[model samples]
Target: MYIDGKWKAGNSDFAVTNPATGEVIGRVPDANEHDIEAAVAAADIAFADWKKTTAYQRSELLYRAWELMVRQKSQLAELMTREQGKPLKASLNEVQYGADFLLWFAEEAKRMYGQIIPSARENQRFLVHKSPVGVVGAITPWNYPISMITRKLAPALAAGCTVILKPAESTPLCARAMMEIFDEAGFPPGVINLLTVQNPSRVGEVFCTDPRVRKLTFTGSTQVGKELNGLAATNMKRVSMELGGHAPAIVFPDADPVHAAKGLSLVKFLNTGQACISPNRIFVHEDHAEPFIQELTSRASRLKAGNGLENGIGIGPLINELAVGKVDGQVKDAISRGAKVHTGGQRLTEKGLSGGYFYAPTVLSGVTEPMRIYREETFGPIAPVITYRSEKDVIAMANDTEYGLAAYIYSNDIGTAMRAFEALDFGIIGINDINPTSAAAPFGGLKNSGLGREGAQEGIEEYLETKLGGFAI
Candidate 1:
């Protein structure tokens, strides 16, 4: 890990295992309280001088980092695929997306405009300035290791806030690689610290409790997000959390089943369904459920599951055995509860896939709200589809969950698409689109999904604190 601008070993180390082959790829530091404090303290010291630098200087450094990321994109993606278990192509795309954040924030850095408020006194000139929130502790998840860190870190650093990034233990190499880019880009020591720790909750507690750390940003589960929110509340630390999601894809009667199915298959099974925003529930009109199911199942079956490094493989191994068990259990419970398994409901134990944890892409029908698969976040490649008669009924079922991260609609009718998307309670909405939104728009969730947004013009504001002042002439 790089701490205070120096490469150093930790008190203890933990093994990093590759999910594809179940082999120990490398080891990262098992950071203790001391390590977490030291990193935060370094960030605090760096923030003093770092925040004073002009936005142009910050943008230059960030742009250089983005360039380096592009240069090393392939290598970074390969390493990420080997570690995080996403397919090589997906990993590469993620790296590219990750680089785009740095580029976007690089340009957005200089555009942090403040407000001029009219004062009650005629002689007073009221002005508001946006300043960095000082030291930030960023906790990113393992799913999209590179991009998630970049999305948060880019904005924070570009906004002149020093950061201590605690990347997921399962995928620390990508974070290390990013630190390399930042160092090569000539960022000052302690301006950014990468700390890899096995005890993430402990490190997170330190981040929440410490007064020196002014802000905390995390991307993970809703349950964990709630706990961390409570912890951050102790110190009144500014927080930006992107939590778990149970996204629903609503297919209205007017849409083309085949097109919707193909697009849904692309996003639904991406990263083997290990994404927070991955479409979880499939709600199709009763009239089109048969064709939609056939199209969706056909597309899913075409997605080959194997080691991420292998070409032509769409779905890879689950992160670990636990992930495999979760998917399997959900499928099993749903099946036992009268749900029909359309295709690919079991695990694959072939010679080549014997070692890794690989569950086949599954499609389930006759799903009801009482089934386990319908209730939980089945973070795997299983699609439990439920049929609905009316738009009003499906919209009610979609908004029934506590999660509201993202919702999808596939409809040719503009009125149906707009009205349905608006009625569904989610932060981001996608109409006839598989991969929803872009780096140019704000991404986050409503309700239990999360707080604060990332990306677009709104992203930089999360790291800045507005200061309002006026002086009478």
Candidate 2:
């Protein structure tokens, strides 16, 4: 972890394991209350100077960081695959995606526009400025570790705010690698820090209650987001949360089933379907349900599951035994609840996967709302197909869950697509697009999915405070 511009260790440590083969990768420093407090104090001090630097200078620093990331892409990607268990190609892509954020925000740093307001009185003048929110504490999850950090880190630094990050225990190496790159870019002491501890709750509590930390951003489960949000409310600290999601990919009657299946296969199985924005629930019009299921299942079954390092591999192992259990339980429950497993159902204990926690890309047909898989976010490679009759019914079913992060419309009809796009409660609606996330777009969700946006113009707003100045001449 990077603390006060130094690569150092804490009094304690925890071993990071490779989920693919249940092998110990390495150990990360396990921080304590003192370490957490020190990081917050360092960020607070660093913010004093970092906030004073010109936007152009900060942009230069971010650009340097981006360059460093690009240089370390192969090394970092391999490290991520070993620790996080995603495919080598996906890990490499994640590094590039993470780098893009830094590059994008390096330019975006100069675009924090203020506003001028005309007062009712002729002699009065009002001006609003976007200022940094001071010290920030960011907590990101295991899935897409580097990508999540860059999404927040680039924008926060670009906005002239100092940050301290707490990456998931399972993926600490990814964060550490990024922090090393930040160090190479010559960020000043205390400008950015990373803390990993055995007691995450305690560290998180400090982030919420500490007066020195002004803003706290998190990407995790909704239950934890709500808890932290409530605690942040105690001190009235600014919060930006990216929480859980159960994304619905709706295939209308007019849509081509083959085209929809082809697209869904890519996004749905990415990261073994552990992504919060992964299309967990599928709502297809009944007329095309059979064909959709057949095509989807055929594609899913053909994908290979094994160690991420191997070539030609599609799906990888789950993060741990717990993930395996949760995914397996969901699949079993769905089957017991009258859902039929179309293609792949059981866990893989075959060659090259005997010691690993691997589940085949599963598809379930005859799925209904009563099944457990229908309601829960199946953070696995399981695609459960639910058939619907009309636009209104599909829209209602899509918004039935507490999560409203992202919803997809695969219809060719302009009117139907527009209606579904407007009616869906999710923050991001994909109109015939599976991967809707872009560096320039505002990325977030509505309802229980999350609290604020992470990319685009709105992304910078999360790290800044609006200050209005009034003067009478």
Candidate 3:
């Protein structure tokens, strides 16, 4: 753990394993309540000075950190691959994605401007100022470990808030490596702190109940995000949540099924379909469903699953045995409910993959609304296809779920695309674009998916407060 500008160890430690091999890769400190208290205190103390620094100073430090990340990109990518069980190429991409946040926020720090308001009273002038919200408590998940942390931390630091990070227990090594860069970049003591613990509830209680932490940011499931949001409400701490997504991809009759299948296939199994934004339910026009299924099945069957470090490996193991079970259970439930598996559907237990948590990339057709896979967020490489007769029916089906994070539409007609985009309840709508999010865009959900936004100008605003001042001229 890195706290108060120093490296500290707890009395006990927990082992971090490689999901690809089910082997212990390293051990990280398991923090206690005292460690949490110290981290919060350190951040609170540092906030007084850190928040007062000029934006230029903060920008320079962040730029230095980004430069360092680029310098050691290969090393960081290798570590992520070993610990997180992602393909080395994917890990390298994640490193670059994470580093972009720091680089983007570095330039954004100088853009925090407040406007002057005209007063109704003749003798008074009204002024508005944006100030840092003070100490921040951030909790990030295991998927996209490096990028998730940097996404929350970059905006917080850019807004001049000192933060105490609680990274997922399964991926602390990546968090620690990030802290090393921040330390080397000359961030003052307590400006950024990281705590690793087996039980997140304990540290979460401190962040929610403590008076020092002024804001809380989290990237995880909606259930957990709601729990934390409720706890933070007691102290009225500001919050930014990027939660669960059960995205749907709709294929319109105007579009070619083959083209749509290729696009969806590329993004559906990204990170082995572990991402929250991965398209869960695919709706296709009945006229084109057969061709779409055929192409998707062929592509899924061709994917090579193995150790991420190996050459020509496109898929890696699931994060753990539990993840494997969840995906398997979903596929079985869909099959039991009358869904047909067009291609791969079972766990891979071949000679080389016997010890790891691997699941075959699967494609299912005839998926109905009654099945578990249709409603639930299947965080795996299972694409369940449902047929739609008309645009109205498909839109209704897509908007039926509680999640409204992201949705995709494939259509050659601009009118149809515009109508669907405006009618869909989701925050992000991709019309023929599979990869919709970037550091330059606003990313979040509309309803149960999440609260608040990340990236672009809105991201930094989450960590700041608007203050109004009245003065006599």
RMSD of 3: 0.8
The Cα error of candidate 1 at residue 251, in Å, is 0.6
lDDT of 1 at 12: 92
Candidate 2 residue spans exceeding 4 A from truth: none
Native-referenced Cα lDDT, model 3: 0.93
Regions of candidate 1 where Cα sits further than 4 Å from its true position = none
User: How well is each residue in 361-470 modelled by candidate 1, as lDDT tens digits?
Assistant: 99999998888888798889998889999988999999999998998999999999889877989999899887776668999999999999999999999999999888
Which lDDT values do the candidates have, in the order given?
0.91, 0.91, 0.93
Q: What global local distance difference test value does model 2 have?
A: 0.91
RMSD of each: 0.9, 0.9, 0.8
Measured by lDDT, the strongest candidate is 3
| Root mean square deviation (Cα) for candidate 2 | 0.9
Better of 1 and 3 by lDDT: 3
Instruction: Estimate TM-scores for all models.
Output: 0.99, 0.99, 0.99
